[model samples]
Target: MTSLTLAGIRKRFGKVDVIRGVDLRVADGEFVVFVGPSGCGKSTLLRMIAGLEDISEGELRIGDRIVNEVQPAKRGVAMVFQSYALYPHLTVRDNMGFGLKVRGVPPHERRQRVEAAAATLKLDALLQRFPRELSGGQRQRVAIGRAIVGEPDVFLFDEPLSNLDAELRVHMRSEIASLHKRLGNTMIYVTHDQIEAMTLADKIVVLRDGQVEQVGTPRQLYERPGNLFVAQFIGSPKMNILPIEAVAGKLPGQPKTASLVGVRPEDLELTEPGSGFVDARILISEYTGASSLLHVQLPSGQVFLVAHDGEAPPADTSVGLAVEPGRLHFFADSGRRAD
Candidate 1:
């Protein structure tokens, strides 16, 4: 296993800067995920780490070596792309062993490595099958097995589960997590899916518009986001952003500089009308089996979501909502989180 370090990393295309001054480190055997929305440079940064893109200005070190000028193959890293990228005519065994074969590894060693990887990925039975004969999940496993056979120092994944169906994505997420535990290689994954980041990563690097937003563990980012962008971007149903005036009277001793307040959907609880922090009328209630999502419109005309377990209040019914003072996240006009 190897650690990775990026110092003042930057990427530019012509005059446009796509990745701006990123510095991060991955510990040995750490699972680090790069997560953000589209056009946010997450993939660009990953490509740079893989030596697939030129780093305009920065230092990239894998293990003890500076590899900014190293070729992709010599960098000792393997990449699993969103697409399986398997050869149609090649069986799983050949596809997984292809890299080793090209490097002139002995036939016996290649077979042993391929079989070991196949067993690890639970693809032993499917090794003789071609890509067209495999299920989506099986094909994805083959792709990962190919990377494993290379015995790379670092494993890079670029949204590898995006092509699978919803159920398969979930299954593959577990599979990948298990693989990480078993191999214990330093892995870097890029995905727009925050759920995947939360579940799979030992550390998450959140990016937005070519810059780093925040870096933390899943719990840290969710519980104490660094800024408004991260607070809103990292949560499901997104945190509700409301003008400070809406809750100024309800929250005493709040910072005077706070211009916006954020409350997560799960943090908002329905209360008796006129008794809670804010009053809103229910606009719609979406029943999602385990819980109901209430879309409530505040007096300020902003709508926020409340997660409720009991039956939801009917539309047009006025209800009061409250969140613990400690749970409320305050932000200034500049979108920075206020202490």
Candidate 2:
């Protein structure tokens, strides 16, 4: 296992800067995930760490060595990409042992390593099958097994589950989590899916337009986001942002510089009409088996979502929305959180 450090990392495509001055420290055996929307540079940063892209400036260290100039194969890291990238003509055993074969490892040792990895990935039964004969999940496991045989210090994944179906993705997520637990190797995963980040990471790194938005545990980012972008991006149904005046008198010790207040969908509760701080008319009530998402439009024309259990009120019905003062998140004019 190895720890990774990025100091003032920057990446540029000619005159355009894609990754700007990122600094991070990943501890040994840590499962760290990078999450962001498309074009946010999450993948670019991962590529840099994998030595697949040139770092315009900054230092990258893996363990105790400075690996900024090292070749990908010598960097002590293995990368699993979105595509399985398996050879159609090669059997599972050959594919898993290909790296070892190329490095001139002895035949007996290669067999032992390949068999061990196959057993670990539950691919022992498929060793004689070709890539075309395996299912999507099986193929992915082969790709991961190939990496495992290399005995890399760190494992890097770039949306490795994106191509799988929804059900398969969930299954693979658990498989990867279990693999991490068993291997205890440092892992860096890049994904646009927050759910994946939330479910699999020991720590989460949120990025936006080549900059680090925030870095914390999944619960930290969800329960106490550092800024408006994080508050809106981390949660499902997203946090609703309203002008401060909407709940000006309802909150205690409201900061004078607060321009926007945020309340998560789950934090907003339905109350008796005229009994809560904000009054709104229900625009739509979307019933999702376990809970209903109520889209309510405030008098100021802004729509907010509230998660409700049991039956929902009919559309066009006026209702009151209440939120605990402690649950409200305040943001300054610049979008940074305000105390």
Candidate 3:
């Protein structure tokens, strides 16, 4: 019953506002992620929950207890930092049990908890190794193991995989996902990577400039974004935005107030000119093994991206871009999503 509730949470550094009126709920055993570009206050919000940062306003509840003034150790939350903050002089076993020792847990019980966590993280073979002797991924696992031994009610991860190589990051993502399944603890992870947000989170909170842009599952955000900013932010190649006039009289049942239209690169297909809604000339084609992304320029000088799975056409080739009527996204003049 470690559900969390944050109501109108705010943070301020002197007169500067860093987090503004954020309200969120996290169910027990849920994997929630906070994602945004750098300096968007995602990490700051996480710190507030961890008791490392003071909350300037509103209430924060963890299982019916308000913890605004609670010390971090008493908050029943464990944080796995990005830097793998392990002791230089201590081995893995000692590092994992150091907190318990400080809190006056009996040495035998501390050893039991440390051994249990080490086995869970498959660090038994490296128990005697120092942080310097372990690889980056192994050190990260040790950090996670250290947190696990605390038996926290909530787990917080702050870009734990940002330092790993691409291959190792992918592997760590897998390991973290499996860890969540096995532990079933309420976890909040922060990252700037949308792919990680999509793959890892049960629900995602998208932030921008210290504000939450939207909150939804990955498919919900991708298929029905709340506004212009989210539509472009959640996708890989990003949803392409075009002036509504470009789609004039093309889409059926288009919203009357729509000032812009969005089409995903994968949704636009190549067709013979005059047969499709958009007539454009290919300027560049990028091949990335599975597909080629074609950049095309319209007569109005607007460049649009289209992805093709079959053989890619050469550069300078003229092509028509076709999109299904239902596949189009309309946005109002205020940048909000429109029907």
Query: What are the lDDT figures for the candidates, one per model?
Result: 0.94, 0.95, 0.94
Model 2 C-alpha lDDT per residue in residues 131-151, reported as the tens digit of each score? 999999999999999999999
Off by over 4 Å in 1: none
Report RMSD for candidate 1: 0.8
In model 1, pairs of residues that clash are: none
What's the count of clashing pairs in each model shown?
0, 0, 0
Model 1, residue 210: distance off in Å is 1.1
> What does candidate 3 score in Cα RMSD to the true structure?
0.9
Regions more than 4 Å wrong, model 2: none
lDDT of 3: 0.94
Q: Ranking under lDDT, best-scoring first? A: 2, 3, 1
lDDT of 3 at 82: 95
| Pairs in clash, predicted candidate 2 | none
Displacement of residue 281 (Cα, Å) in model 3 is 0.8
